[model samples]
Target: MSGISRRKFLTCTLVGAGATALSLKTTDAFASAKLEGYPDSMGVLVDLGRCVGCRSCEAACNREQHLPAPAQSFDDPSVFDQTFHNGQKRRTDEQAYTVVNRYEPTATDQPVYRKSQCNHCNEPACLTSCFVNAYTKTSEGAVIYNPNICVGCRNCMIACPFNMPAYSYSSATNPVIKKCIFCYDTRLKNGLPPACVEICPQQVMTFGHRKELIEIAHERIKARPDRYIDHLYGENEVGGTSWMYLAPAPFEEVGFDTTMNNEPIISNVKDFLGTVPMVLAIWPALFTGFHLLATRKHDIEQHGDDHSAHKEEEKKS
Candidate 1:
């Protein structure tokens, strides 16, 4: 066996360890519980047909999250016209975890309103993209953030398919990605409906287990086929979302992104994750065997040299 150099050995070990850690993170990120969903996962079902664009949900969310006041009050309808980056209307920001957007669907004189926030996906893209593992998917179906451990990479904001996360650019002291937390801290843990759901006077949002909510949505559609579209948005879009929607018009016409596939956003990175187990299983054995071989070779060389010196001394004696 050939002796290994210190640099080479360190390199091999470091490479193997790095690969193992990366693979494990990716695997854990993608490996959600069986993909059906967590047991008794809570969710919200939005019935767009029932929403009167009251903006009450927005007000409730703002108060519940205790976010900074917005430039336009939640009572202001002109907020609908406020444009931000990319000529897009205002999205969930530091001040608001949830916002409702207005759309005038074709063939309907009355405007259609849609709510926007973190979908709290079953396999959240933000969770997977976070190398620090700062994002977590709770059993109650909330996608939560931990700002302390966050490296401020802004990767989660980019990874999110919905573009839901917003950063506090003005905060020079400390900045973190912010999004809806499903009211996990204040309400979900205590088995209460979110502030937005509890406050909707029009009963536009229904809060319940994800499975039950899906059934209820379908039942509602079955009962009033004429009032709603045949499809259930968010039921299986991107491997399901805690918050879903029922629209009277086609989903795209009501400000929904219909282009997303049924597959989870994590599917984009699972390929790399599949290699994690392979590294974990192979790297240790490979490196350890190599280290032993090199060590044994060195021991044999030293022993041979010692034995030769002993023989010379004996002959001289």
Candidate 2:
């Protein structure tokens, strides 16, 4: 075949084979699949445009979650100036389930405040990557973790694209990943907004079903397009997060990582997972065939030599 024709033939064969395999695998997955978690679980959406950096939500979360008192009180504006090891500002930690970061927009006279917390992804990387099955995604759209089952491997921390989960590293004996649980055991189970959302003086945090929140966010943007950034940060990041954002300034200026692609975090790891089954199914047959081919000539020659020696021995006798 001509070079171009041969290339086309190879490309067609590979594409056809890949499509066939993918179809079969998807069919099998669907056949065995069952939905997970509580379907009616609730979530909170914080509009950055409305937050005034009052830190009321932070204080309420601290009190409700029974976290230790901050070195500076929630009312302390000094917390905004505090810097961590990398000159990065303090983020949510083991003691703080959520935090507000200030971003000064050059286009605006006043600084905008943005809250950072567990984004509660639709297909949480923490849930999928936890080897011990310590994480669960509830139907109400909360991604929660069971510390009792956690092995302290910190896979979830590494897997999280939002950098949400913080480890209790100070406690050597009982270290566990910690973050917001959407008030699952308390308010969420009872169908109430989380402490942070309930206590926001500015009505900055709106708690509801994730799907509804997306609509609400868009409506707010449409009604006041000039007042808010046109985009929702978490709408498609990591395959759509349960908690979404509507900000006045660009998300990057507000300390949000804008580099993340719209693809789910798990999608980045799919290539590795896809290789597992290919290696498992192909290795045995490939190695066995190689071993047979390698040993066949030696076995045939030994048998022929033995027959010749036997015949010579019989003639001498």
lDDT value for model 2: 0.81
Give the per-residue Cα lDDT of candidate 1 at 67.
Answer: 88
Clashing pairs in 1: none
TM-score between model 2 and native? 0.80
Q: Write the per-residue lDDT of candidate 1 for residues 228-252, one digit (tens) a residue.
A: 9988999999989999999999888
Model 2 lDDT tens row, 1-317: 24334544565566557656865775567445423323554556778888899999899999999999888878988888877888887787899999988878776778988888898887788988999999988777888889899888989888988888999988989999999999888988778888898898999888887777778989999999999889988877777787888888888888888998877766666656766776677566556655654565576679889989999999999
- RMSD (Å) per prediction: 6.0, 6.4
| Runs off by more than 4 Å, candidate 1 | 1-33, 280-317
Best by TM-score: 2
Which candidate has the highest lDDT of all?
1
